[model samples]
Target chain A: MLLIALALLQTTPVAVAAAEEPIAPYAQSNANAGAKPFESDGMWRAFHGREGVDRIVDGLVERSLVDPRISDTFKGHDMVRLRRVLKEQFCHLLGGGCAYSGRTMKDSHKDMGLQTADMGALVENLQAEMNEEGVPFFAQNRLLAKLAPMKRDVVER
Target chain B: MRIFLIMLAALVASPAAASDWRGDGKLVLTDGITTVEGAAGGGIATWAVIAGNETERGVGATAHASHVALPDFDLEAYGGAVGLFDRVELSYTRQSFDTRGLGAALGLGRGFTFQQDVFGAKVKLFGDAVWDQDRVLPQVSIGVQHKRANRGAVIAAVGGADDQGTDYYVSATKLFLAQSLLVSGTVRLTEANQLGLLGHGGDKGDDHTAQFEGSAAVLLTRKLAVGGEFRTKPDRLSFAQEDDAYDVFAAWSVHRHVTLTAAYADLGDIATVKNQRGLFVQLQAGF
Candidate 1:
């Protein structure tokens, strides 16, 4: 069921982009949708081999930091909400998109004190998660820098 | 239960030799390269080399205890480090400098001694402080050390200050994993001259000077790392000329949960003193 949903998502942006135009060359038809999915897959392969992202996310969720309540937070919403958020965060950060409409950084951590100790704990948790996912250090660093600035806001002590 | 306990012991002491394992040495004092591991003096207490960033963010910690025995004197110290992140590190240490019979040689009463408590933190700014394959420049970091002199009179008599000031520094390190080599250098600016609080104000001029420090490490095999460092200090006190210090070290990983590093150190000057030779050791453990 998840695979079908992912496949549908994988094809949506391309189909939409194609539908907006008149019939073009069959060769151009595949190219017009852009090459982001392939590139994302390449990054996934470099750090975590086949199905790496799934393995990583699985380990991350098991760490208990993400909160099982997270699923409940968006449970009633359609799969589109989950996919859109992931695409915007991961895809845009990876250079594929220019827009991200998630909650403001401060809003995301409003209730949490997120002290120095907490941040340390989070970093350790993520390191373990990435290690389990086989993410390389350089690659992880690049991804982490995107969130580094938030340290100032997230950590109160 | 016996079998389970043995298995647990094996797991606890298992040697972890992976390039990425951060818990292979003393935890608290060693940051990626320039600060002490939050812990102190299980060995090599007289230098400015911090741990690599790779271990800073992981769960690894370093704990050590040291004893310096000489014909006329003996000393002891303890400390360790817990790496909060690859970017930030925190450390603490306490040292007891026993005068013993040596106090009489210096015209002081026997058992006259000094004690020091130090706390430190270092944060990496730019570049990878440990592994940077795409660039030749080593990783860069900045940190500060705050020391409190328990014996204010002992420290002040030698021209030291009552309140030990914070010492600031910036360091860069490069690890050539493919070649099994590591090199690091650091520059520090501080009011406390020498490792001692003894030199509060420079008798010569400005209170601060650029201290050049460097370290080199070579891996003889998968489980062994041999290294050394040289650092130059400024002459700030009229009473004594500060000399440089050097140390040679060898670290062996017996298992994933345990690694031990041993070093021979020479701290150039203490109260116009010469050639202080001692041994340094560190034990580290973590996931």
Candidate 2:
């Protein structure tokens, strides 16, 4: 049944277009529908301005502090510095051209005995922050896809 | 039952004590429960999602028990599956089919049962079901199931060609995260008769034929999903006609490690018993 529906949609150009339509809640218009996510620094910068970036990081840190699953890992850390480095790292990865000045993922996470669960918790917190900031799902996914490879470096167990 | 409890206890206890479990790295309501064949999927159809919460860097395993009670028949299955690197999956399932009064009528003796074993493996070909929101392409997987029926003589007497066979399938699954919708389509080529319990092939058709299976699910909450599935079947027996199967199900993730699913299944005509409708329930524990 799903295959038949998909085939039908594919045969009808208008239906296919409608199916491919973006459902971004924060999208002002469909003007960027044809634009690829993370294709250019301009797109990244426009999707989340400096203020949006700051808010996203702030949201992430706030959520992490209360998330029992990973809160222990954050103990005794300087949240202010951590937040600044995270913002810079995300900006750099998203093509904002803000060079990351923090330690490499492996070096920073080494000896911390970070587990896959901790990485998962952090990702969830980041996702929630993205949601709060009204970041487009596509944009968030693109960013995540870039950061996903770091799992090898961050997770020791 | 004791084994099931032991497995569930181990899954929960070990994960909690060691903290080695992957947790919620996989998307919520995305890692579906083990299907009857032990693959991750809906009631009757297989999806392309990998099993458990292995993600792309770790290993995860799940144990499941399912029961399907029909008007004239009942099926009980238990199995476990393991996902490696969120790419390959291997599973094993044991099924016991009770024909109830139908067994007596068929002269196989009252309360006679037929048992079968299924071994399955699947590999993800490409795409990401959860994170590929920017593209229309869905995750695709290719899989195979090898089935062996214990009652070879009975199957041969019923005009079955072989007591063992293999089924091959290709499945594609997609998740529209923002819309909280999931859709999957699978095409299987098989010559199995009654899912290989009645054996493979038959006098009517001794060759493999393509069958369709599909599912659509909606996430009502982070931990709850409601879905429906349709699976076409092969009519291989000359004695009785077989029809398609379908189910409407709701699954709840009670915790990161446990899921419970309940469904209303319409298996159409199985053997000569028409309208074999019933309730299906499955419990899965994983990490």
Once superposed on the true structure, which residue ranges of model 1 sit more than 4 Å away at CA? Answer: A1-157, B1-60, B67-75, B197-199, B202-206, B285-287
User: Per-residue CA lDDT of candidate 2, range B258-280, in tens?
Assistant: 89999999999888789999999
lDDT tens digits, residues B44-140, model 1? 3223334322333243334445555433445565555544445554566566677786677666678877666667776667765333443576677
TM-score of 2: 0.72
Report fnat for all candidates as fractions from 0 to 1. 0.00, 0.16
- The clash numbers for all candidates, in the given order, read 44, 0
Q: What's the residue-level lDDT of B265 in candidate 2?
A: 95
TM-score of each: 0.54, 0.72
- After superposition, the stretches of candidate 2 with alpha carbons farther than 4 Å from their true spots are A1-60, A66-119, A126-157, B1-24
DockQ of 1: 0.03
Model 2 per-residue lDDT at B136: 82
Candidate 1 global lDDT: 0.51
Q: Name the top DockQ candidate.
A: 2
